[model samples]
Target: MTSLTASESATLERAADAPMLAQVEQWAAVNSGTGNLAGLRTVAGLLADAFAALPGEVRLVAPDSVENVDAAGHVKTIQRGDHLHLRVRPEAPVQLLLTGHMDTVFAADHPFQSLRWLEDGVLNGPGTADMKAGISVILAALGALEASPFAARVGYDVMINSDEETGSHASAALIAELAQGKTAALTYEPALPDGTLAGARPGSGNFSILIHGRSAHAGRNPEEGRNALIAAADLALRLNALKSAELKVNPAKIDGGGPNNVVPDQAILRVNMRPSTPDAMAAAETALRDAVAAVSHEHDVHCHLHGNFNRPPKPLDPAATRLFELVRDCGAALGLPPIGWNATGGVCDGNNIAACGIPVVDTMGPRGGAIHSSDEFLIVDSLAERAQLSALTMMRIAERGTV
Candidate 1:
């Protein structure tokens, strides 16, 4: 592990605790749900102001158009709020990418909108753990790094999008573009409460199958009616049965059905699939296609499948493993307890960054738990601990020119 100089150590030590937590409270108060465009814009403005403390050019880049399939099988376009991009020292020899998201799983109407102390050191609120606190950690770390003498040795591009929770449809292109030519990346996703990081992640795909059939009155001409609901149920069952050790299939929801007296003409099946490797992802896709074809032929109904694996599985390649080791070393130097990592079923933007061929250590944020739930909480002390860890890691990488 590279050692920190006296000046660098002092700068890291000055990353105050009270101010960082205060910013967390300020940001968590606003509801920046993935679907809340207006609220996301408000949060974007707040983040832009806070991140302005760094030496860079910060701008709100407009989101790209994304498509979604509705219950009726029509493709609709969605417009998301702008993503925040900050470019600092792009001309430096070593360039790194830092990413985070401003959106949360909670909606504007969600009941978990306030922040309060659950205990002496635990703060509870929506987005507090899921990522508002993580963003604060990123900003605080950057602020401390800028105060150090080696700040000019490295340059980084920060991309904080508003559509991560819903799949980064709008900001995906931006992430790929910024990640190009960078040596490494750091993403501020909150760590598990135990400080265990997520290592390899499975690739996920959400599918919506729409079945179309002929409707008829049950009492008048029951035999002439083709049951779309029954076909949808059959498809769901087939998908559920496809689950195995490598691939996990979940039939999340079904929509469209009417009175018992009339045979329903339309039905929609929503399903989620997770594949642990590239080969598994390929096999899962082929299996899904075959299932859809069989169901269409057997039920005599037109079936349409929508959605693809947005985030590919992030494997622990040699480069990624080296990056994790660097983080572990930094953690040890900062007096943090031994850090560990494990593969998780959940997917995050790290998968996308890895897809760009950039080695990334994503969950370098504060310790927190119960994300995506009303009971989510952030450990108050981890704010400063994680900031020092990230800042020191960045400084080490900048000095060494590689991990």
Candidate 2:
């Protein structure tokens, strides 16, 4: 394998510290929450401009757009008629895919849409660490590659899905299509605070359980009432009890109840589950069915559950292990720690891409903490470093021609 020489290494260090911060600052200012259609278009415009500047042909895949949620509760594309694809030198055998999402956990009306700086180098903002910064990294890395001598060895496709924050319902097909013949994929999810990547991720699914029962007045005929809320409570306990080493089930929210004078007739429970493997997922589903069946039988109320797996688990394969090695070497050359990874129960767009048989490193973005909360922040230094690492890794893979 070829390595970056002394001069190349110096160039990489400078590239990592490039003026990419300004670009990130600008992009972070835009709130591209998945449910925000205008925001999606706004970010899409920026991406279009960037891709247009590159020596490639860019096309919009989604012809029309709508709003929807994926199983993961990330803001997701409800209906997708189009998507954007940037293609350069497609005839090249060493084609790579670089994917990311523009949506964040924040909503259009979310107060957290504003950006701020924390102590030292942490910059807090909605979607900053989750990924707006990662987009900037891609641009910067591409900029560097455009100037590098080995640019000719690489051909790439960049896709920024509008609905990744959600389960990527709209973009799932597009991601699969793009990965069909690619050598590898690089996803720009935020790295861990310590700069570790994700080696494997458990499959995730979202479920909504609804309960129905006849209502009756508490004072007039309490015994005549069949309480749906009671049945829901029973189901929730049963679901929660299913948690173990292989599966985690959470009945997260409950909605619907009436005045004390009447027995509640309807209830809704929202649950989320993550399983380490496909078999674990099946077990969880069976357990859920059993719980609902038992509750319905005892309470004489109707129960319904909706939703299933959005993205399957991304297990590390030989191809992924090879990609990880390349990334580790790049990190070491950049004076960072050895590239390391751990399995996570969390799901991302990488899961979607991997489901298509494309080996990928999902958390290749910035390093930060407290994502999806008020305390979320981005490690400013990670902006340049991760971007440079990604650019170098892509160039290296292109030269190696995908094992």
Candidate 3:
């Protein structure tokens, strides 16, 4: 085992003493799913109160307005809960961004709401690893950092948003705003169960294409009516065909359809696209517009598209590689395994942070797996392990000026 310095040992001890498991249980018990506004509110308040323990100003920023395209092809406004932002030592020489999300994929009405021991050292529940436990990790690591002498050398901003599970639509601007002018960033998205990190994530775009056409009784005027459902089906197929090595496509659903007796007049196609690079992302959007245009002209229907690429592909640029090297060095100093990373399909606020041109090692949380399912679990012993890793990493960055 690598020997730790006196300060490192003491700081890690403080981080280890955080009530992470207890906090996870408390938060996982609350169903703060993206669509559950009330639940998001409750959890955001709880997080604000907890993070307030740090030396900083804690504020709950309201989510920006989000629009949804209905089955009837109408765009309507949707509500989301506030996001928690905490600022500490803002004027310090070394500034950092630390981020996580309060939202989970499990909804308030979801049945996978109870926490249970899956084994001696494993606990299963919603948001246990993705990422209430991650939030706990952030709190613990910062608490330790604040106690150490190195605290004076570093400044940080913590953002726990309410809508990450849904592509961070309501909080995208906030992520970009906080990411600006940071020395480095650490996002507490859980690591792989074996402790490997995610690197070079692909960008994601979600869109709802509303199609409208003339309606008529199927038997009486089938030829006279322009079927919106058929046009939507054509659009879905066209969108799917746009898939390639750089871009992956999924036409997930069509929101509108009526009686078999009539030619349906309105349908909203929900599709998602993932592009591995910025060029791919741009080309994908252009191909999409072309497909939509072809479908509209061929089927004689009106199509309205709504959405943008919420998360841009995060490439391992030179700056990002340097940050990863720093984190790996910190892990080595702790006598942990040689930390390494690989590209993942999953996207998070890390993508947004990376887009701001700051170096970031996003998967700094504990070893956990089966996220977004009833089987989600966080390794009990990993709480202290990861917090220590985070605390030391930040301390080292503070000791120096950059990653």
Ranking by lDDT: 3, 1, 2
Say which prediction, candidate 2 or candidate 3, comes out ahead on lDDT.
3
Error of 2 at 303 (Å): 2.0
Candidate 1 least-lDDT 10 residues = 11-20
Model 2 misplaced regions, further than 4 Å: 1-3, 6-14, 63-83
lDDT of 2 by residue, 1-403 (tens): 4456664565476567666667667777888777777877777787687668678887777634444333332334354324567777778778888888877878889888788888778888888888888887877777777777667877788888777877877788778878888899899998999999988898888877778888999999978998988888888898999999888888897776789999998887788889887789888889888998999999998987767778787888888888998899888877787779999878998887887888899988889889998788999988878877987887778667883
Model 3, residue 24: C-alpha shift (Å): 1.0
Deviation of model 2 at 99, angstroms: 1.0
Tell me how far candidate 3 lies from the true structure as C-alpha RMSD in angstroms. 1.4
Name the candidate that leads on lDDT. Answer: 3
Which segments of candidate 1 are over 4 A away from where they belong?
16-18
lDDT of 3 by residue, 1-403 (tens): 2567899999999999999999999998998989998898889889988998999899999899998877667788989989999999889999999999999998878899899999998999999999999999999999999999999999999999988988888899998999889999999999999899999999999999988888898998888888998999999999999889999999999988799988988888999999999999999999999999999999999998898898999999999998888788888888888899999998999999999999998899888999988999999899999999999989988987888
TM-scores for all candidates: the values are 0.97, 0.89, 0.97
